[model samples]
Target: MIEWFTAVQVIVALLAGLICLVLGFIGKQPNDLTLGSIVLVELLLIAQLVVTIVAPTVGNEPSGSLAEFYIYLISALLLPVAGAFWALIERSRWSTVVLGVVGLAVAVMLYRMGQIWFVQGTP
Candidate 1:
């Protein structure tokens, strides 16, 4: 995994999360702008997933233990997609809450990813 990409994702996730909360406070539903932000975050995550899959095979040093990387990758990749679907199912405050949760999770995963990447060469 590219540490820089993971860092960028984390920042993006945090900004999205804050937006979700603000939108939720202003209104109980997500507006078009909120939806657009969600889509952008999803695209970035998909890109991260693609790069992660290719990194190991392309001579990049493996980040952390392989098992850990895969676990984080799958969960990080799933959260936003699932949240977006769930958000559409209910156009209420809860939907925005879900988005916040997903964003927070993505940020946490990015931190974990960084830890894994940096710890690989340690004894």
Candidate 2:
């Protein structure tokens, strides 16, 4: 729910997505760089999870629908896992593209989550 933290997440997700997209386009297979970036993004998501858990108890409660925010958060958490698993299973450049897509998706979702937390009546 913290704006600065959400900004950080969005930036990292964007970088991850860009990196994977570039690698995929360059014909690079899924490797440590690609996988590691996804891992980094996932770590940030975990941090966001912790922040969301602690924020409410500390009086930084969301202004929008908590359920909607949580749904976005949970879905964002899943994308990287699914993308990484698919990359590992397929071991293809296209899998790298999939990871890129996942990263971008998480970024957009995080932005929406911020809206859901701070801007009421978002639809």
Assess candidate 2 and give its TM-score to the true structure: 0.96
Please provide, for model 2 over 51-70, each residue's C-alpha lDDT reduced to its tens digit, 9 standing for 90 to 100.
99999999999988898899
TM for every model, in the order presented, reads: 0.86, 0.96
lDDT of each: 0.78, 0.93
Candidate 1 lDDT over 41-101, as tens digits, reads 7888789778877887888756468678778878887888888888888889878877877
Cα lDDT of candidate 1 equals 0.78
**Candidate 2 Cα deviation (angstroms), residue 10:** 0.1
For model 2, the local distance difference test gives 0.93
TM-score, candidate 1, is: 0.86
Off by over 4 Å in 2: 121-123
Worst 10 residues of 2 by lDDT: 114-123
